[model samples]
Target: MQRKKLSHQVRVSTEDSELFRQSVTGARPLMQDKIAPVSKPGKKKARQAVNLSQNEQQLFFFSDGYEGFVSNSASLSYVQPGDDPHLAGRLKRAEFQPQVVLDLHGLTQQQAKTELAGLLAYCQQQQFNCACVIHGKGLGILARKVPNWLIQHPNVRAFHTAPKSWGKHGALLLLLKINQPELALR
Candidate 1:
């Protein structure tokens, strides 16, 4: 009896569905067909990669003359103008884990600059919001240059000196822009 009832319900549902489909068959689709085009999620990421790779020079240029002087304090912190003012503080508290890391341990200044540019571009391309930059608070040249360069980049949202477990004063936890157009540099 239960099987009969189930079959009956299925038959009724199939008949109703067929009727509904027939009723809609005579109705014309919208003339404009105003649906916007949307790329697949994977394609979107690939497109970003292509855009960054193709137009990288114009996208990420860090100038030493961007600022005459940036303080070299052990506690480094920065936040882009329109971003959350407390972002650096939140980063220091380890609210977001760094998904990628770029270590400048023994690289020359020129090498470091190249690596920095590539890392920043790659982060944007890959849609990574958080990354760690281990500048190794050395004789202060790399540390100082690193922060200055970072501040100049339009995409760096916020950054703070890494906490004890991450790298302490020797590294910085960076909040990078992900899947968003960069804010104009100040």
Candidate 2:
């Protein structure tokens, strides 16, 4: 028997080969272009974690250490003469009544340091007996740094973590200069 050669048409069908070539050319750019990067969530709590409720009071400190509060206070009407940079001024309106507590969870380390000092001076000058400091239970933001500094401050009669209902590990109840609890009344 004689050997026979395969027909050219048998090697590759024209229409199929053209289709394969078109697909390969069309997909080349997709392979060459860099893929879009995917974003990863931070280990820290989500934005919802820090958002406040309807009745929740706002407390924020500026880069210069000026504090702002969202509640009303009777003491806000008693204004001191001369401009004071550290004083909250209108920002001090947050409710500071004996039972009502304010949170300080959002301050940065440096802001908290200044806030601690300003608070001590406020107690020494105006005579507040008790105050709350909300220092959010982050990585040693307040547990180590704030307490260490508070230990040496003059007006800090006592300071401890707040009750669970108020802020738990996220806040502190500061007993200001005890002798002047009456000043808070003035």
TM-score for each model: 0.63, 0.40
Summarize candidate 2's per-residue lDDT along 1-186 as a digit string, tens digits: 987876655578899999989888846434556778999976976432322331122122222332222215212111123333333332233223333244546777765665555555555455566677677767754555555555445454555555555465566666554463444544
| Worst window of 10 by summed lDDT in candidate 1 | 43-52
Per-residue alpha-carbon lDDT of candidate 1 for residues 1-186, written as tens digits (9 for 90 to 100): 354455444346888999999989879766886788898765434312334453457335677666633555659888988999999899999999998998999999877887788788778778898999998866867888888888888788998999888888888899987777678999
Instruction: Provide the RMSD of all predictions against the true structure, rounded to 1 decimal.
Output: 16.1, 16.6
> Largest lDDT belongs to which candidate?
1
Error of 2 at 109 (Å): 1.6
Q: Which clashing pairs does model 1 show?
A: none
What are the runs in model 2 whose C-alpha is more than 4 Å off? 1-102, 178-186
User: What is the C-alpha local distance difference test score of candidate 2?
Assistant: 0.49
What's the TM for model 2? 0.40
